[model samples]
Target: MIVLKAEVFNDGRHTGENIAAKLETMLSSWGIPKENVLCIVRDGGTKMKKGISLLIIKNIDCLSHQIQEKFENEEDPLLWWKVNSNKYGILSPVAKEYLVTPPTSVLSERVFSGAKIFYIPHRNRLHGERASKLLFLKFNIPSLQFNY
Candidate 1:
């Protein structure tokens, strides 16, 4: 999962237009075509729904959220779709994609927490480039392997 942005919102209200503009800006900055954006998974907030509707892309509800609402344990909705994929035929692939979406922004929040740690009092004087390099290595180095 690529994190496009991680900044605090200073706006008084989060309107649909504002959300759409932000999304557009992010997509444009990354040179990602809007057509490549499959679906948006967001909480069922009025503004979020409105913003998604403005994007002209499909919107899916978070699977973990549905499980939380109706089940005591974490249920794998993708497993259910896998079992029923043969029954659904062509639509199965699409269902599987939607099922894998994260139900919340907890992962991103964790990254922000890590950033806060790196930006502590004494180290706060670190330049933006240095801070960014530190964060990049902090988050990404573990994923690399030296097989030699």
Candidate 2:
């Protein structure tokens, strides 16, 4: 398993197209077989062309972007924004911008959330998927106090 640290950007110039190309180049340079590589891009709306190119090059894709997309596209847009805002917070306008148009870096949030799931505990109970969802709804909905 080769872990090449890279900063993925959703910027037009640094889109999945360029990222995938870079992965291929990096793997080849390191003498790693393309088939042995796994490319975990943090882009959810990546067009099929870019995804197919990565797959054809034999890198396994991470589902973080897909999961984020699924949550964001839920029936209730308010709930979605609330969840994201609670997660991203208002400390940085850049983070707020990401909540609206998620940049590639948002994948880090997802990864750390997964880690938090394993770490945080409530009343000596490990929060399972159902409880976690409920907690997310509870915390995210009631905590939203808009200044407007």
Candidate 3:
């Protein structure tokens, strides 16, 4: 998880088209080829859904909060994926990409998300970086204004 970009949303219009345009500009600046986007996890806002659809990538409901609950009561998901990656074959890589996804984006957006699941044993060896920092990066999303 890393903070790649940050900017103010001076224009308070959170329309889907406007959001998509802003997203495209950011993606362009980051040199992220549009086609590489496997999926997007978004909140239950109409504009959010529309904007994600505009990107033409798979969109998933924001399930990070639920992930915390699951972790508290069950097994680690990343570890599960690592163990089952071979069994799933092609889907394994897809799971990896989605596992790192953030829930949403705002002014201080996180380019890469899903770091909240980093509480596993391996997190302590993350080059001396703090777990809180990783969680912050995971929650960072590109800036946009919308009703939630």
Candidate 4:
């Protein structure tokens, strides 16, 4: 659920190559080595798939993605993966990690929703830097106060 980037883009078209380049730049800026990025979890959109593929990282399907097709048992995929982790030998840990993939982009959506609360019509004149700082504090203050 970590949010590495929350930028507003005005690009007319978002192509796979452009997305991949941006992702690479973002990862490098964060000091996250390419090898450390094990997998990317995204929807089945062609653009998303192509972008992730260009990154040279494994791309996995969003477990809880909604589609017209339905499975017989509607069990939680993470739970199922955990229960069967033992069955996978050398890849067991990878399996568990994959299971941790967020079923949806709800966390990012929530952050956007929270940001909207701060940027009300009356307060829309706030400077971009001020707004960013306020949003950062609003989201991270709780973690900062932890005893650990």
User: Which has the greatest TM-score?
Assistant: 1
Report the C-alpha lDDT of model 3 over 52-92, residue by residue, as the tens digit. Answer: 68987555555552233234337777788787766555566
What's the TM for model 3? Answer: 0.41
Query: For candidate 3, what is the lDDT?
Result: 0.63
lDDT score of model 2? 0.55
Instruction: Give the 10-residue window scoring lowest on summed lDDT in candidate 3.
Output: 64-73
In candidate 4, which residue ranges exceed 4 Å CA deviation? 66-148
Residue-level lDDT of model 4, residues 3-77, one tens digit each, is 887544468567888777777888888999877775545567777677778988665565456333333577876
Is candidate 3 or 4 superior in lDDT? 4
List pairs with backbone clashes in candidate 3: 100-113, 106-143, 107-143, 109-140, 109-141, 109-142, 110-140, 110-141
- Pairs with backbone N, CA or C atoms under 3 Å apart (clashes), candidate 4: none
**What are the per-model C-alpha RMSD values against the true structure?**
15.1, 17.2, 15.2, 15.0
Candidate 1 residue-wise lDDT, 65-116, digit = tens: 4434333257676776677666544467987876675789997787787789
Candidates ranked by lDDT: 4, 1, 3, 2
Candidate 2 lDDT over residue span 1-148, tens digit each: 4566554555657555676676666666778776664445444446534844754753333544333455434466555556665453432345445556445777557656655644655545655686667656644665676444
Q: What TM-score does model 1 achieve against the real structure?
A: 0.45
C-alpha lDDT (0 to 100) for residue 118 of candidate 4: 80
Q: Whose lDDT is greatest here?
A: 4
Tell me the spans in candidate 2 whose CA falls farther than 4 Å from its real position: 5-12, 15-17, 45-55, 59-61, 64-148
